[model samples]
Target: MLGEFDVGGQQALLDAHALVIGLGGLGSPVALYLAAAGVGELTLVDHDTVDLTNLQRQIVHDHASLDRPKVESAAARINALNPDTRVTTITGRLEGSELDEAVAAADVVLDGTDNFASRYAINAAGIAAKTPLVSGAAIRLEGQVTVIDPRREDAPCYRCLYGDAGDEALNCAENGVAAPLVGIVGSVQAMEAMKIIADVGETLAGYVLYLDAKRMEWRKLKLNRDPDWPPRGGGGGPGAGLGGAGRGWIELDKYNRVKKPKHPWV
Candidate 1:
């Protein structure tokens, strides 16, 4: 399996560093594939515990992981799949200085988080560290993926994309999601992460890809940087208040309109 990928670049990933912010649906596959791809170091941060419902899409956990910290469950799976990759588990929420420290050491940060608050923190940290971020989300049969490079002047940061965090958001518990949707997007995240580290292929830095399982259709949207967006600071600037200002952040309600066009996807 490893041979099919760039073998010469294996060391790049093996020596490369990554951080996954959540261990739920999308996080599971993203972490698993990166580990399997031999990413040298991976840090997983999540405060949630595993529940039976997670098994539907969070394939990293099994019957044994129920009631266990999600980070531990994911770490064990990654280490078992690829002993070469170093796995670190942060068994709680990452915020403020701690979140900054975790993201500062990574070459890429995967936005597997489900909420806006965490997403905003990851975005600020990635921008501060000038690291690339691979963001993915899946709800129902739909998924989206985008890459944000804060170091690049033309590419927008996460906050530039979303307007704000506190308007109204759906927790996964309230909103339903499809089982395989996250899998598909998360695997794509792993691929995009490798390409970014290797400096190969067309990365999803300036575009967003949306997938609909019910229709089995895919759509690519062009994203342009918002010139008026403010830098990372929790203030009242055009972009300051928004969650993922420069990076590609989705407005769930807006997305649902185009992604579902009928019933709610999530």
Candidate 2:
């Protein structure tokens, strides 16, 4: 497949490390595909355990895996699928130095997390580490996916599109996502991550793909970087201007420093 696709620019997929920051719906497909595609290392992070509710969209977990840590279930499935891939499981929510350290060690990061706070934290880590991020989200009939590359000065980061508004996030638990919505978005995220690792084709670094499953329509929108947003590892300080809205600029470590509302969804 690599030879036919001319992927990785002579860099083998067997040497790449990918960090997936959730093991729920979106993370399920991303993890499975990356492992199947022969990514050498996968660092799976999630604080939640599998529930019967997650079986609707989270294909990585099954009846026997109920009540198990999502990372454990995901790792088991990945191992069963591809023994060549090494899986590292972090069983809890990663924050502070732990999150940054994981991102720093990875060749790429995939944001399958549900909330804005986690997304912001992951984006910050990716920027600081100069790693590419494949971000995906799904709620109800709507889904969106984008690629954020901190190495590209002109590319818009995740925060550039959605500021630090954790409270505003509508998760599947609340909004009730369609079963296949996450599958579609997560598959796209995996494709994007593989493209980045393989050095093949154009990535969605500056654009967001929106999927409206109800209407079965798709739209792509170009995103612009927020000028007031601080550079990678640059201090933005609390309350710094963030884009057009009155949203305050939160620092990279905001997730660790602040106490946030506990959302039920992963």
Candidate 3:
């Protein structure tokens, strides 16, 4: 099993707690893989119900689970896969203190959510909790995955990448998504989380992975902390920026920070 790869890694995964937000397309594969891999505890949060359309990409739910709350559907599937994994389900959207409490209780948080507002909220909570975040997104045959570790001084949080970009809702309901694209992104997210928790392999703390499914190509981009971004663990307070960079006002460098792919296939 996992012990052959990393000594005592199986027990390490069994001792970890993970909090997952959203149980849709990306979440489906993330939750399934984590449970199958022996994560000790899981906190699942999702407000939506299983709809007929979700079956296209949400593999955790089936026709039997139609109209059921997504958390319940996902929990059932997880239990069926691994009864040893304990699951705590929250069936509604979490905000404010609730989100903070959940993030604080977990060793790692995974964001399978679809919108910017939810991502921003999760980022703020992860920063306050000093927890690592594994984030994934998929829509219209494209996907992206990134790991945000607030504990790292140079690692960029989600806000640093999309400052002031109001939540422009883009989802599979409105934009068509490839059936297997979410699986690819979500599986990658789960793998990153496992590596972080087990303290094995090189984590993607400062890199964002971009997937172009249509062309079957992948790109990796380096991320930088926004100079004006609030200090980590400061609870949104102002402090000396990373590298002692002045913080009156700084322009976001997301557009210029992305490194073009040298080789199309990796």
Candidate 4:
């Protein structure tokens, strides 16, 4: 049924492991989908316990999950979805050395955490560990998802976008979010994660997908590695596309169109 995925791709998912940070809005669907997709192992991390308020978009949890650690609750759902998946729960702030170790252990990392500091830390750890990070966030009526893979030469890290800009984004707790916005973002995150693990198809590798639910619009913003990134290297980095041959930052719309065909009987 999936022409893009062959036996090798399914096997790749079974042999891969993904580390998911945060088990709230974004993490909920990310974990569930990854498990259902047959990711071999998952390491779930979150320090918070499920609250009744989380039920709205944190679809992985239920009324019975209240007061339970988010990692535990999400694991329960993952297990029910696929009993073969190896689930590991870490109910603590995964930072410093612990975060580094976790990222190093997995084939890919999914970042669903909402705050800047946490995102920055996860980005640095993923870069250090040379693992891919599939990051997603939803707040208010908008959401965005991107893949930051240091392992992909010249690919940007999460810090490249926000290191200088700083994050003005507020958490869902401090703001109101449309119930399904996180679902859309999280599903995309999961899709990107599976692509990285299975090594199939083009991913959101060098682009960030932004969704504006108000107008129901989606935008793919090109990403450039920070000029000052890696700090010591000159501003120039690896060129976009394969083998540094691509012109920097191409506009996909121009190349991906087909003119209406001429009618023979016209």
Task: List ranges where model 4 is wrong by over 4 Å.
Answer: 165-167, 231-266
Tens-digit lDDT string for candidate 1 (131-176): 8999887765677888888778777665555646454555555677
Among residues 3 or more apart in sequence or in different chains, the pairs in candidate 3 whose N, CA or C atoms overlap within 3 Å are none
- Report the lDDT of model 3 for residue 32: 99
Q: For model 3, how does the per-residue alpha-carbon lDDT over 1-266 read when each residue is reduced to its tens digit?
A: 55544657888899999999989888999999999999999999998899999998899999999999999999999999999999999988788888899999999999987765677778888988899999887777778888999888777877655554432345566666788998999999999999988988888887778788879999886666766555542233222222233331122222112211222110
lDDT of 2 by residue, 1-266 (tens): 45634555425578899999999889999999999888899999998899999999999999999999999999999999999899999988788888889999999999888776677778888898899999988877778888989899877777666555445334567658788888999999999998898788899987777787889999886666766766643334233223333443342222112223474323
Candidate 2: where is the Cα deviation over 4 Å?
2-4, 7-11, 231-260, 263-266
* lDDT score, candidate 3: 0.78
* Consecutive 10-residue window with the lowest summed lDDT within model 4: 257-266
| Per-model TM values vs. the true structure | 0.87, 0.86, 0.86, 0.85
TM-score of 2: 0.86
CA lDDT for candidate 2: 0.78
- Ranked candidates, highest TM-score first: 1, 2, 3, 4
* Cand. 4 Cα-lDDT: 0.76
Better of 1 and 4 by TM-score: 1
3 versus 4: better TM-score goes to: 3
